[model samples]
Target: MSIRIWGRPTSARTQKVLLALAELGLPFELTLASGTMGAHGHVAKGNEAFGVVDTPDYRAMNPNGTVPTILDDGFVLWESNAILQYLAMKYDPDRFYGSDIGRFASAARWIMWENNELIPPMHNLVKHTIRLPEDQRDPEIAAASRAALGRAWGIVDTQLSRTRHIASDSWSYGDIPMTIRVHRWALLAGVDALSPTLARYYAEVSARPSFDAIRDPAMHLAG
Candidate 1:
């Protein structure tokens, strides 16, 4: 079966999907869109490489006009985390989703937590720092988000001290979301330091070939 990913590479959510694909060694086509190209009115045509999927057309694939949507063997899916889980289960189930119910459930729990708890604050940090106009940016909100993120990082640091991976002793889907967020954390405002354990872990994960291939330093939310 063929797999296609539609999104810009710099997006953290898109990185989630791409990272899973890289980990699984799945060969898929990437259709680039949004950001500069979208702003310039270049729309994606049918299944072309590096083109933006048209909104009406993309909505047909995914009702939401969001990036990082995936098409697997004609079955369309959205949500970056969900796409990661699907790729893991379909291509690398043994290692990613894990082989047993308990393991899979544990991984799923962390994925859910990352989406609901971790990503919002992380998104806020990135958006307020870079996406918003200077006059429109809210320093108070950014400060609050960074404070919350520090607490979250502390909890993650504690967990990493005890476990090599987030969900279990082995790497699983749990690493994807947290790793992506940690990359953002390294760039976020007021982040002068990270826990030693978390910093080491981030170094290890970010150094992966997959990360090196897709992560663009230029896309980092500019200070």
Candidate 2:
């Protein structure tokens, strides 16, 4: 059965999963689900309404009612990074996920590192600088978060200095999350935020046709 994803298109994580699906060459359906990020099914201005996630019916399928929940055949899954690994392993394991033990571990490592080390600051930066209303925005938090993000991503820059992609010389599923987040960085912090190595890496990743999945004009820069 074709996969179905429930998530608001404006969500960065949702767009990340969409990019992964496109990269896997799989066809899927998308439903607009709302969350703390924005109004439900609000694909454009003045379209906000009660969201699917706010209903008991959606909660019955996935208790969290989170964005980018996927029903693949009978299996249900959420969390964009988890969804990325699932689709890669199930549909395109060798190339996207890597069949070798070391290779698989390598892809997983960077994905985890991205989640644990890089994402906190990136989210903080966005929350302080972009997500909150101007009156509620905190320049101090944004500045500190941006600085922390740059320091953390320095490891990525060093790694990229030696390899073409995060896990290997070629693109891997591990690169998908980072690719999406890097775009967010560029949009929020400015293109100059990237080191030379990171700039090249971003260029290569975005050049891929699958990256088009995250290119919707209505999407927010911080998302």
Among all candidates shown, the one with the greatest TM-score: 2
**lDDT of predicted model 2:** 0.78
Estimate the TM-score of every prediction. Answer: 0.85, 0.89
Candidate 2 per-residue lDDT, tens place, 7-92, comes to: 86667778878888888788888887775645532323334543788789778777887777889988988887788788888888
TM-score of 2: 0.89
Model 1 pairs whose backbones collide: 44-52
For candidate 1, what's the RMSD?
A: 4.7
Each candidate's root-mean-square deviation in Å? 4.7, 2.8
Q: Point out the worst 10-residue segment of candidate 2 by lDDT.
A: 40-49
lDDT of each: 0.74, 0.78
The segments of candidate 2 whose C-alpha lies over 4 angstroms from its true place after superposition are 38-50, 217-223
- Number of colliding residue pairs in each model: 1, 0
Superposition error at 35 for model 2 (Å): 2.1
Q: Which stretches of candidate 1 lie over 4 Å from their true place?
A: 35-54, 189-192
